[model samples]
Structures are given as structure tokens and as C-alpha cells.
Target: MTANKGLVATAGTELDRLAELYGGALTYEAAVAGGIPIIRTINEGLAPDRIRRVSGILNGTSNYILTAIDQEGLSFDAALKEAQAKGFAEANPIKDVIGIDAAYKLIILTKLIFHRTLSLAQLAPTGIDHLSPRLFAAAKEWGLKIKLLASTWESRGQLNYQVAPVALNPSHPLYQVDGVTNAVVIDSDLVGTSTYLGPGAGGKATANSVLADLASLSRGEQLTGSSACLRIENGRPLTKQRYLVVNPTGLPTGLQFSDRHATSALTPALTPTDLQRLRATNPGLETLALGE
Candidate 1:
């Protein structure tokens, strides 16, 4: 499971050991293709600058649920059930709903994007567990779309990473993304915003990708340098934070919910301390990151 820290670590360890045995070995899962070095190499091929920021919708289950809520007006429970029935979600769906799956993808992407390997613990991920369908309704009323996005970017010389529901205006490229399709948006100076969208489900996509990779390798094409070792720097810090708070509760003195009932806020970013305080006050409080 990508969401499980121990499991992800074990897989990474296996990848490490396997690469030692087989240099050109590749993992062709959609997650790996969408988040790892394959996409990184493509970005480099097209853009002059290396990847400075990477973000996207990494989980099909979560996207399916969000689409159901937004388009079908289904509650979280019903949407989750439908996703499970369609094989979009697992029987035990904790990882998909909670944003941990997306977070794990972000963690893996960070390894290549920032050249830093970060622990899941240090990431302080916030899941969609407590999210209410009302958030979607309110967002729709405001001409915005709600999507669970995982992002890694340089913020004030620090790499900020998180997986959370973020509101996007129609103008943004990701606003139209729906259903089980997956997308990754890379931002760099040369390329303003490069959006890649493809089916995140079905085995055929990954199978084809791996086959293509084998073809490339057989032709003696090496896209990236040796990734045998990682030089990790101090991981990024989440600072100067703000969140769209759901449910009226005791936020910090300076931080407050936008409206009592339903509304919006430009909203100051919450510090990690502020989130800890808010979470302590109300565990069920839901938050959406305002923007990049």
C-alpha cells in the first residue's frame, strides 16, 4: 500500500536493492510512472529548467469520490461505496479517503524533484476523512471545483508538501479533471504549467508504459543519471499557513472561520502550530489549502 509508511519504505528499500542488482530495472505502476523519474525525464526533455514544483491528483479512488459528490450529489459514504463496487477503491479504504495515498505519491516525487527523501511523519499529511459533502456544494456555488491534490513546491527556500482538498477556479488547468483519470502538473520557469492527464485505472496503461520503457532500454536509451544514491537536505517546512476551516470551533486568536454558515475567505495560511491547536480543539475540523 502506498499510503502505509512501513510498506512504502519497504518498497523503496526493495527498489534500492533491486537497482543495485539491475541498473535499468523499472517499476511501471501508474503511480511510479505518474510520480517518479519517468515523468521527471520527460519534463527535462521538454523544458530547459529542472522541475521546481510538482503537484497533481494521484489517487483515482479519491477523485472518483470527489466527482460523485460534485456531479451526482452523493454523500461521502455512498460515493465511497460506489467506488468500492466499481473496484476504484479497496474494501479497506482508509488510505484512499484520507489522502495518505496521495501523500505517499508526493513523498516519492519529492525524492526526485527536491532530491530529498522525507518521512511520512515529517509530512504531517491531512486526509479527507472528515470532509463533508457540503464543502463540495459550497465550492460549486462559488464556481470552484474541489479536488484532493498532492503537491511539492519550493516556498521561500523551503519545500512545502501536502495532500489536501483545494479549491480551483475554472481557469486553472486542473479544474476540468474528473472521475478516475489521473493528472500531474509540473511548474518550472521555462514551462509555465505542463499538465499531463491519463487514465489512472486499468492495468493496460501501466502495462504499456512498462513495455515502452523496456523498448527504450533495449534501444540503449538512458534518460536520467544514476539514481543509485540520494543526497537528502533538510526537508521542507510548512510555515505561514492558512486553511479554510469547517465547523465553528476554537481556532487561534488571529485565525477565524470565514462565515458561520456557508461562505469564502482569501484566508491566511495556518502555521503547523495553528493546525495542531485547531486539531486539538476539534479533531473533525476539515481544511482546504487556499492556493500555491
Candidate 2:
């Protein structure tokens, strides 16, 4: 019965233990994605399946800012101001902009689904303030959209996660999730893939989620702690991944690229080592991971 993700996520599952000890249920459906019922979906609907990955546009303020930059060609400051005017952002908006808001949500989900604890220090989230209209424009040249994506996945028996700005191709499920709207794509074994999309904020939206939790309480359901164990790993790509490199100075020497733009280029599938070497070879180059 908490909407404070910062407290719940950072508290290291103690709240869950206390609730179970007191024979009470702790429901936090509103803490993650507003009105999405994602927690219930995972705890009930998708409980039987094995989830491989969970990714989403979790922050309404950041999404609104990025969407404004992409659709209206607005500068970052201008877009953020517009979001505040539209009530999509807070007056300060520091947590939302710096990816801490989304990181908290991701940490909560990781605890519930993967039974792992992740600290913000371990997450090392990347904010969207570094992104510019030029990055969005470059992505558009390849039918892509830039989004502040929060993702968690299992790889080689280890849990890897990250929250950052990603270049999503059109075919991706989250590509069309724009503005203050939120969307979560869950990849599981039995059901394949399931997507949940809706308005991520507002009194009515969050109230609906709160009401759902109340209903579950009325049904006499008690909250329980995760009884499983999982290995947590830092944000690292185990497999090859494509990247969109934006360098106003042009491509780096000895780098092979295709779909070249004036200030950016699409890189082939590269390993983490290759990306590290490329960054060493060329300083100050913005590299965005291309999402599937």
C-alpha cells in the first residue's frame, strides 16, 4: 500500500518482509507505471511464465520531453518547459530528468520478478539531458525514435539492467510510445511477448491502480516476499548490439559503418570490447544503443 518507489525500492525488501510478518498485504501497483497494473500482471497474470526481459518507457516527464524534441523539433530546455506547463513534469523535475525515477521503478520490478536487489549506485542510470535534437534527427533518418528506456533482462544466468536513452527502430513495440503515455514490453517464455500501454500519470489514472490494490486487499490476499535467488550483474551487453554513433566531427578512423549521415553513422553489430575501443579511438562521440 505504498506509492513511494524511492523508499520501497531502496529499502531492500524490508517492507515486504514486514508486511508478511504483520499478516498484511503490501500493494504498490501505482508506484511503477501509473494505471498500468503491471505489478498485478506480473504477480498474477504472468506469474506462471518465465520472463526473459522487461523494458519500457517508464517516466512520463522524460518521455514527454523527448517526444516534444522529436515531433516539434524543440530544444531540450524548451521541451522540458513545455512539459512542466502541461503538468507532465514537476517544478524541479530533477529525479525524472536524471533517470532516477525510472530507475526506482525498474528496481522494484527487478525485486518482484527476479528476486534481486539493485541499488541506484549499481544501476548507474544515464539521463536524457545529454541528448540533443541532432540525435533525434539522426535517428529519424533511419526510421528510429529516441526514448529514455528502462530495461532489465536475463543473460547467461545473470541479471543485467540499464536505464538510458535508446534509439528504437520503428518495428520495436516501444517506438510508438510517446509523450506522457507509457508502455511496457514483457518478454516471457510461454506467452511470447505482451505489451501494456496507457497514460502514465494523472489523478484518475493512478487512483484506478490504487483501487485495484484495495480490491485485492478486500479479497483477503496477503503479500509475500520472494523466496528465490538471482545473481545481479552490472549493465553490460553479453551479445553483439548495434549502435548509432553521433559525432559531429565525423566517423572515427578504421571504423566500418553503413547508413552514414553527415554527423552520424549506423554501426554494425559490435561487442562491448569493440565499443570500448571505438570510444577510446574517438573521444566525445555520443553512442546510443539501438534497441530491438
Q: lDDT per residue, candidate 1, 113-215, as tens digits?
A: 5656677777766666677665666576666778888887775556667777788768877888899888888887676787888876567776566565666
Q: Per-residue lDDT for 187-225 in model 2, tens only?
A: 988999999999888899999999988999999985433
Candidate 2 stretches greater than 4 Å from native = 223-228
- Candidate 2 minimal-lDDT segment of 10 residues: 221-230
lDDT of each candidate versus the true structure: 0.65, 0.87
TM-score for candidate 2: 0.96
> Which ranges in model 1 have alpha carbons more than 4 Å from their true place?
1-10, 21-24, 27-29, 33-48, 223-243, 246-286
Quantify how close model 1 is to the true structure by its C-alpha RMSD in Å: 4.6
Native-to-model Cα distance after best TM-score fit, residue 139 in candidate 2, in Å: 1.4
Candidate 1, which ten residues in sequence have the lowest lDDT sum? 225-234
